[model samples]
Target: MILTDIVSRIYVLNLPERKDRKKEIEHALKQIGIHWQANQVICWPAIRPSSNNNFPSVGAYGCFLSHVAALQDACHAEHGWALILEDDAVFASDFNTQLPELAKVLSSEQADLIYLGHCHVASETAAPAGLNISTAAVIGAQGYLVRIAYLATLLPYLEACISRPAGHPLGGRLHYDGALSLFRQFNPSCRTWIAQPSWIEQRFSRSDIQAHWWYDRWPLLRQCAAWARKFKQARRHAATLN
Candidate 1:
């Protein structure tokens, strides 16, 4: 019901082989003084043959499963809400100060999905803490919140998506982030919201799933890429109202 309560049950989706990400996530949480559980990321090698061909690639399917794994656990947590984070997630400079108000927004609005961090589409306005409603298509899964009630429906939707391909009018593909947005689109009853100035952002990393070796590997390039990302986000944020 409060920020402390939300922080207590955070789940970080991470690949077992990526100890680098694991340690980095731990350090990030430490700075915010929060606790977390590392949910091991699912790998393509372990994927079922039938579902293997469903997604665009092995990495995409793996990412889908990792998020599903986290949702499965979070759906059954003692609390009615769950906060899910990817290992590469970077908190906003003011995340801690703003987080406490989230519980109130969650309670009053009864949002099915709350994007603590997101990308592609920026928040439309400088809405107050409890009022940043998502109006357009959004992407990124670096961090978000899930309501237990919605998770019950979400898990099943995801199960059905395994055989569906991305960009399907009928909710195809299991790429976690895209599917989530699709879920909202198809399920009109599901209410989704975003925390403006986003609570977290996915940092530059040679992703375990997506390709970008130059930016994810070299420190200078990574730093530059990070800057570029910031600039893009700022531009989107500014242009949202126009």
Candidate 2:
């Protein structure tokens, strides 16, 4: 599949110092026939804590900011849709084939956001082929496609957070992905979904922000617990629907 034909604009978030990670992503893209361009790399800002306890950690804050930067660019760009990817994203072997199909589905449905990859913890069950739209339960901003029209609502909400002083009630409560989930809940027009059998996976790398010993030592157990929580939530949601 021709990537440019599917989505004209693609942005990858990377820190300036992480040239190695940039190179790795570029090489992987080339293997999939995507020509890596320097301009495609969005330089992530330096990590710094807010004066108050708005953000959970400097790294989380920086990660959130990087996503905002990508959204701002998408709002400014001419394309109707844009694909945003993190530098550490590992593409699946069939990414080229699957992504174009996903794009077509999103366009036909006028989807607001579709996660191309996500953590399995709290993951919802996959939708069947040809009908992939569903209310997302967990969202990992590692790789996603966003429609520019949705950014019309999203930008103002983010800008409001930007205007607030640190320690404000809403200042740092939401990470980027969390913000998206909330937006979908409050905005009746907003629609979102996850692509089943994610087309990408996050590469195992030491996080530049917050560090947790348990995540490092017992990753599988942590993921299992997450899934358990998701299943419980799903049951509750189903009961409500009935």
Candidate 3:
């Protein structure tokens, strides 16, 4: 199988209304020598929030469902791993060269989920020298790879959250990436990681979900908080393992 085929599947999430975004992503991928067929680039319709919806806005809900859709697809895929990307995600120039190395690391480590591109607000200290992967704290959903085995666990949990009554404790106050972080915290079996220097980065574009200025302005503070949370979670995970 070709190097691209090493990944069971690759998907780019696009909205029907964002045809321009789709074209832009296609162009970017072409520049990187990756060409995806129409079936591989899934166009998800944005979910409009209503009075009965759990999330704060239609955009938030749509974003959440789009990720769920990706996970659902991975659960049924014949391949062991899948790569999911948002339309605005851009590949690093070395991404093609690093793809095999990444796949080998994740497979050897048996990681459930790995962030390909995300904000660097998860840890205060750098990863051990030469280590490409470290535990993820607060990941952005722009680009990630998921193991099909882990999706088997994650998909059911997400479905449960979706079916819960409005106002339920686990209902919809959080974004999809946040929910995934919480899930990893609670479920030690679901290993997660981030690439030290991300292989992809999100291109600036009109965001579908609302933005928080506080997060943008105080990234160091956010990273500190994430580190604290991860520390507590590591302690708890250790207790369980013991």
Candidate 4:
């Protein structure tokens, strides 16, 4: 199978603090026998926004911007679908094999986003065989796959809104929340198959000082918040199952 026919390229958007993160992830990919160099991957400089920005810009805002910028640059340079990933995410051994299959499914269905793995509503909605999707968040940056056409469509809007939440405690690169809001707004939810085993996340630092405050200062509060959200999502999924 021409892997490029399914989805042309893949990449990672890393943070400035984690300098070694990319090399490690790349090494892992090689270990898994996925030759990323043969596949297209554009590793841009990690984002370290100057303090003078309109907003604090602590989050992956610039990183997300950089991710898209790289996508545009690479696409202009080569031209095709670009799969975006984060530095800390680990892939399954079968990731390369899965890509083309997922791409075929996505194209056949015309889905806006094809989730590799994600949290979901409990209801057992039937997804296409060999793949399914939900309204849940995939540890997205782990390995987000995007359509070239879809990327072109969303790039301008993402560019426009990337700066919206900057400076806030929640701001940073890879605006998953903002992107999710935009996803639901423009495209109705569709099939995004959850990776049978979600990708593993490596330990990484959150550059946002505010993240440290919530996570470090109020550790209990952070745990509570995570538990609560997980609980709600589980409840919803259970209801669907019922």
Candidate 5:
């Protein structure tokens, strides 16, 4: 199935300052035989207005709003489906080969949403080429396909999260992806799936959404720190379980 047939519009979350990222995604698309310039992913510009609600940072708030804007555009369009891509997305070699199957699975499962890539997936050797979608370990908003009709059900929950809360018994994060998971949780009818061996991965460049003065300047330091802290805590948790 041709992508154009299923996904009528592709929106790339891009910032004006980040021409380099736009170039990278465009090249990746071309490699996969998608003429990005011809198709022209509507480059959604970055917005950074002040957010009164709590977030990790201003960047995080902007990122959340940006995803919302992309989804809104997708919903408004009469397109069949919408492919929302973060500018940092780099396509994989297998991505092109997998498109037809991906399209098929999405149709067969009637998935309202499917992640092209995310943080992790189960190493299911049994069904390598089959749908490796699982219920957990799939988080992040970098790359995903959204069925046009499902947005109506989704937008309310997302918009609700934006409002100054009245009161909720449970604590939850309000980041875009987190809100997505919450929506899926509250409404089991929202069929969500994930692609195995992710079609896209975050480019190794510094993040526009979550950059830090020190980390962006010296990324290796950030990686090393994460490794050191996370690994130590992981081992500690394992010991407690044992």
Candidate 6:
């Protein structure tokens, strides 16, 4: 296995709406060889005050971010690797079958990040192809297989600075971008890809983002801003060359 030296621990980060989801995840884990420790699955309530300013708070996104931070820390403290999943995700056949080969691939290439497994192409016809070279295969976080050493640097900052998108009072925000920022901070030259053939099916942004109480928005917004700035610089350079 690519990471035989690293122990695999799985955790679910969840909120009130996710009780059923949590059960589903737990069952899936049990079916595999991983023994569940109660403390491993952490839950935080999503509690944002409504605009009315009188009713009880309700939102899960914020809580999700908080849990992500906690999981990152817990993974580091335990000296083990972590696989983080949302309540809604489901796995497929060969999930276990592919781990050894994937791990071998990671080790052979000296990869810094393992994106876990995800379907690069949603439909049946497409093929996955975002990896940079033999060393690193770019993959999505859908079913992430995070190495603790790589994630320790960003845990402290995750809970703070996340907020709703600009001009959208009731928008959804997340820290994938912020996490990417940390990936760049630690590695400088980060490579990513979708794992391939399989992926988590989440409701895309076709619906308006649901509001959440504890989701950090600022960090993500800042990351977005940075991305825009970089894109603009690239555009300018291209124009100059033209």
Best by lDDT: 5
Per-residue C-alpha lDDT of model 6 across residues 1-242, encoded as one tens digit per residue: 22233445555555555465566656655545444455544333322233422111223344335446555555645544566665544454335555665655555534444555443423344445433222232323445555566565545444332443422332224334334434444454444334554433321211112442232247676456546654764564455345
Which lDDT tens digits does candidate 5 get at residues 1-242?
44555576888888778787788777767776666543436778866757525765677677878888888877777546788888877666557667778878656747778888666653444335435554553567788888888888877677767663523422233566766666776777767777765667666655655655485466698667556654664564455346
TM-scores, all candidates, are 0.76, 0.74, 0.76, 0.63, 0.78, 0.54
* Per-residue alpha-carbon lDDT of candidate 4 for residues 1-242, written as tens digits (9 for 90 to 100): 43445566766666656666667667756654545554465555556565424433455445555566766765553434566666655554455656666666656755655555343323445455345555544333455556566665656666655665453333323355346445544555433445444433332333332235455357787667656654764564455346
Poorest 10 consecutive residues of model 1 by lDDT?
40-49
The candidate with the higher TM-score, 1 or 5, is 5
Q: What is the C-alpha RMSD of each candidate to the true structure, in Å?
A: 5.6, 8.4, 10.6, 8.0, 7.3, 13.8
Q: Could you tell which candidate, 2 or 3, scores higher by TM-score?
A: 3
Q: How many clashes does the backbone of model 2 have?
A: 0
lDDT of 2 by residue, 125-209 (tens): 5466432666656567788888877787877777666556545555434566766665666665767767666666666554555
User: Candidate 2 — which pairs collide?
Assistant: none
For every model in order, what is the number of clashing pairs?
3, 0, 0, 13, 0, 19
Identify the runs in model 4 with alpha carbons over 4 angstroms from their true place: 1-6, 15-17, 36-39, 52-57, 77-79, 93-100, 106-109, 117-130, 135-139, 163-174, 189-242
Q: What is the C-alpha lDDT profile of model 1 across 1-242, one tens digit per residue?
A: 22545533467777777777777777777667765434322221112223446576667787787777777776655456777778888776556777557767766756878888887664455567543666556788888878876777888988778766666677767567888887877887877787766678776555766645665578898778767766775565455436
Question: Considering every candidate listed, which one attains the maximal TM-score?
Answer: 5
TM-score, candidate number 1: 0.76
Candidate 3 stretches greater than 4 Å from native? 1-3, 38-52, 128-133, 165-171, 211-242
lDDT of 1: 0.68
Superior by lDDT: candidate 1 or candidate 4: 1
lDDT against true structure, model 6: 0.44
What TM-score quantifies how close candidate 4 is to the native fold?
0.63
Residue 60, candidate 6: Cα error in Å is 6.8
The total of clashing pairs for model 6 equals 19
